[model samples]
Target: MKRNVLLGIAAAALLVSAPSRATQLITEEEAKLPPPKGAVEVQQRGILRGPKVEFVSPGDAASSPLRLVLKFQSYGGAKVDPNSVKVIFLRTPNVDLTPRVKPFVQADGINMQDAELPPGEYTVRVDIKDSDGRPGTAVFTLKVAPK
Candidate 1:
């Protein structure tokens, strides 16, 4: 009876994961890479000098798990890989290693990341480009106080 129950549980687990098995989840490291060549691209019309990126989260707020969101006021209909958006540290946060995350694009114009960070002074930089390879850059100041 025990063996049968274990087997049934294993089978059910596999069934649940089968649909997502083929789906690819983007890694934080991969998020930093440029989007692939064949991604959907719309014409670059009324292009701004650069991507107008802004932070939606508090610039002075400190939390153990920090949430970062950048909204692009104008992208010229360019496509960016949602997974490719990241909060790159100019210098290490308190932790020796940077946090890993799977970033996604929200329905709004924000690219967001939830990062578990150590308490320290931090300057984070975000670099992103449009499908046509036009680049946008933004910097933010964040201070994490140790709890």
Candidate 2:
């Protein structure tokens, strides 16, 4: 009986913390800036070339399982199919794409990826190119908090 009560309390705490953690990512001041044009706004890396990408959902944290959905704009203000927009994620901490992450695709209107990574400090490099062969690179860092 005591174990059941503790479990219920823990579950309730999780439910309350999840949404707040997500919302805490974006602030009103950052939203005031003009949105990126025809490129991936790699958070702190500034703007680089590629189909424009907007985070449908805010926040990109290093959790056990990371879910990300990116909406793309046509390259250079022209129509470019998502297929033509190649996107890959390279593990930056180590000079390889191996044992840590898997690449994903943007089939429809959005680029969605779900990556399950071990808990550690790491950086991921985003490599992208358009149909016309314009290339762009941006680096994103993830520090996984220990459980």
- Measured by lDDT, the strongest candidate is 1
lDDT of each: 0.51, 0.44
Please report how far candidate 2 places residue 7 from its true position, in Å.
30
Give the alpha carbon lDDT tens digit for every residue of 1-147 in model 1: 999999999999999877531112222344344433332313345656555557676467566555555675435676654444444554322221122323245423453345455565555566555566666666656565565
Q: Give the distance in Å from residue 90's predicted Cα in candidate 2 to where it truly belongs.
A: 6.6
Error of 1 at 3 (Å): 24
lDDT of 2 by residue, 1-147 (tens): 999999999999998877432211222233243433333325635565554444452254456445545554546654434444433333211243322222344522333344444555444444545666555444445444434
User: Candidate 1 at 1: error in angstroms?
Assistant: 26
lDDT of 1: 0.51
